[model samples]
Target: MNQAVQYKLKMALTINWFCYIGLLVLFAVWNLFLEGGSIPLWCIQTLPLLLVLPGLMQQRYRSYLWLCFILLLYITTGIVDVMMPTRGWQDGAMLVLSLILFFSAMMSSRWHRLQ
Candidate 1:
């Protein structure tokens, strides 16, 4: 890949990593500590994310594609949570993180192909 493409790919991958890890941490904190949710519920929320970790770590385009699909569920949940009458910052954060993660992951996959 050319220098420009490499730079873009690097940036995309950086953003993807940040948002991906941020969402994972947010989910853990929101479900486990902030919401006092059940362990099973937390696992349910995070298991899919965890399942994709190896592929993501390997920088697989397929993993990024799958992550985008998985993120749709999170984005929908975030939207619903934000619309609740008693919505908290966590809801907004979740929505923002998921959206950012979705786009970044998509771009990462695209950039990977260009590489």
Candidate 2:
């Protein structure tokens, strides 16, 4: 990749990772404080993120591609949550974060392919 595209891709990837982590924290906080969720359940919900962390840190295109697919589940969950009267705000937050992550991942993958 040219320097500019490389820089953009790096920035997008960083943002994507940050947003993903933020979403996890949000979910954990929501489950623990708001929903009285069990610790194991919270961990289980967040564990899939760990699977992608190493690859994301390495800026793997394959990882970015897979993340796009995985993020869809989150998006769907967010939508469902938002549709609920009681959980709308929390789910809205999740939806926004997922959208950001999805955009960044898509950009990173696209730029990597162009490189």
Candidate 3:
């Protein structure tokens, strides 16, 4: 790839990794610590994200593609939560993070293909 393409790919990958890990940490803090959810519930919530970790660590384009799909579920959940009467900042934060994660992951995969 040319320098410009490499730079774009690097930036996308950086944003993708940041948002991906941020979402996971957000879920853990939201469900486990703040919400005081059960261990099983927390595990269930994070399992999908966790499943893609190895591939992500390996910087596999497929993982970034799959992550975009998985993020849709979280995005849906975030939307529902934010619409609720008792919604809090965390709900909005989750929605924003998931959206960012989705786009960044998609871009990352596309840029990866260019490499």
CA-RMSD of model 1: 1.1
- Per-residue lDDT tens digits of candidate 2, residues 1-115? 5889888977997898789889889878878987566788778778877778888878788888888888898898888888887775677988999989998998988988887
Candidate 2 residues lying further than 4 Å off, grouped into runs, are none
lDDT of each: 0.89, 0.84, 0.87
Candidates, ranked, TM-score: 1, 3, 2
Error of 3 at 26 (Å): 1.2
Off by over 4 Å in 3: none
TM-score list, all predictions? 0.94, 0.86, 0.92
Q: Which residue window of length 10 is worst by lDDT in model 1?
A: 30-39
Candidate 3 worst ten-residue window by lDDT = 34-43
As a whole number from 0 to 100, the lDDT of residue 76 in candidate 1 is: 97
- Looking at candidate 1, what is the lDDT of residue 43? 89
Best by TM-score: 1
The better candidate by lDDT, 1 or 2, is 1
Write model 1 residue lDDT over 33-76, tens digit each, in one string: 87566778878988988888999999999999999999999999
